[model samples]
Target: MANPSRVFAAVLPAAGRGFAGNEKEQVLEVHTVNRQSPGDRVREVQVTGTAEVCFPADRVSVCVSLGNSKESVAEVLSSVSRRLEYILQTLRQHGVSDKDTVVRRYLHRAADLYHMDAEVVATFSDFEKMEQVCSVLLEKLDKSVCVGTPQFYHSAGCLSQLRRQVCVSAVENAQQKASEVSQLLGQSLGPPLVVREEETKEWRNEDGEFGSRGQGAALLSHLPHRPTITASSRVSVSFSLRDKSRKQL
Candidate 1:
């Protein structure tokens, strides 16, 4: 006997009533005795795509630390406070704002010596000014201030804009691939059924880590090129498919 047409009947739960254990059995059923006209079947195509873009680092961050061993907590604190004030003044004179500086202080007792330390982090957008600032710290602050390696990075607004662009490019890639497959199969591509972001990642320059040295003015010279800031995205998309006959005119 010929197989009956596939029938999809949704038996939803009754008002204020529920089925126990046989819920799956109650919701759907297939019968071979009687047949109804077949309806259009929903179909989907899934594809994965990725995109990446790199931008030059537009900002630099310099970290400096001051440490002093004194007889009493008050003395140590007083000394560190003076050094911090001087550093802040120097940075401000070079066009660095208070918002661009971060200050941290600590006090500890170790091996019968009272250790007090202060750290100052300043960010700069102008490369020449950064160089001037670093040079002045080394010359004026002398051995008391230990300069850290300079960090190269992009501004937050720059990164956020790039991320949005990359995501859009990834989705466009997925749609292109799906359209090609649909064409090959003599089907029409419909609107996306599901669009999802699978992953996002960053790729850094592999040459060497910047500002690895604990003290440096010479090291700054070696950091000639700004580090590359890469933005990347991957997406998994599911698009609906329609038969040739069902395609829109």
Candidate 2:
């Protein structure tokens, strides 16, 4: 009787079916046989495939703040309100919807003076518009207002899509590998017997800050090291094999 393990191992290429790399792509073939009877033998090939996908940060949030102090509460409120309203109006005029803006105010009396501080945080999907809005606020408000640096990050929907894309790519890679191995063994590829995602990982760039000023400063800041997120998937697939000679008969 033939040794099933040796027979299976010798059928596939020693170099494996796909290109080898640093965990970016991997392929391994596995075979199992049923020894219940020689005529009842079952053969299958299993391969592991890996893939990675990267995406840049899609959303940015900028905070604008102003404060004032006066001997009376009414004076402090009046002074702070003027700048706060101006900031809100500027955001709206730049096509920023109310739902994307958050407003917060704080009031307290320190010794003899009443102090008021207000902040407006706006989220933007359009980078160009964000840059324009930031420039307008900083130029008009001058030293009286503070516009914070832009913070970039990916949205939940973007992350969801990335995961789906990486997984599908990994599966396709596995199928390709299986087909190649099957052809090399003088057999035809059949329907998948099993498909599973073995592992998944995600990471982001270490430096997430973009600080510079220029014509395309907003877009340029992402160069060299943008705040990008990468997702990787490892999938295991098992495909049945059909003998060409038997199928022809």
Candidate 3:
């Protein structure tokens, strides 16, 4: 037989690597350990957490699309440009600063999606501003009538802060759950064997739907009231186990 000190090797496959697309990563890990000493250990577990923080959204976006069609494509574009300029200027006159007021989307489609001759868009920070701008455009600007949805957004700073707070809360929850499990198993809770993080920011309608009939720009004119913000998050923690068989049991 081999000596007690002889080393052993093992191999295991894992799911894969993570991407930066989301607030968290979806992955599986494989660990291979050699019990070098008498007291060495090997254990595996899976844990997950869902944590979230809700803060009043202070930002919004609006899009206004206008169009015109002359005999030639160039004439149509020129006229459309003129109309959009007026609308954008109207928005600016009403406290919609250059920074806050942006042209969101511009398209030269042979066929108008809204079935209008042409389209242009203006984005704003919130509903109050959007309402004011909307009023001015309807009252003063050309009312050819094909508008897209107005979007709502939050700054990176706000999202980052909320993400941190929610992640910490999730970690705390996972720890509590782990302690309970350890107690039930008649084992002392040990430090976290592994810590993994995940985050999510979801926006839902009042009815809990993923999206609404008029999302972003489309909702601007259709919505009776302004839209609101909705966000959520989740986290996971892993702990090592030493569930040795107790002779008593």
Q: Give Cα-based local distance difference scores for all models.
A: 0.84, 0.86, 0.61
Candidate 1 TM-score to native: 0.54
Off by over 4 Å in 2: 1-42, 208-225, 245-249
Global Cα RMSD, each model: 10.1, 17.2, 18.0
Ranking by lDDT: 2, 1, 3
- Give stretches of model 1 more than 4 Å off: 1-39, 53-60, 66-83, 104-117, 124-129, 139-144, 152-166, 183-188, 197-221, 224-234, 242-249
Evaluation by TM-score, superior candidate among 2 and 3? 2
**Count of clashes, each model:** 1, 0, 11
51-154 per-residue lDDT for model 3 (tens digits): 76665444666667665554566666676777777876777676777766555434444644322244445555556777777777777764564445555555
Candidate 2 has a TM-score of: 0.74
Q: Number of the top candidate by lDDT?
A: 2
Model 3: worst 10 consecutive residues (lDDT sum): 204-213
Task: Compose the digit string of candidate 2's lDDT tens values, residues 132-184.
Answer: 99889888889999988878889999999999999999999999999999999
Candidate 3 deviation (Cα RMSD): 18.0
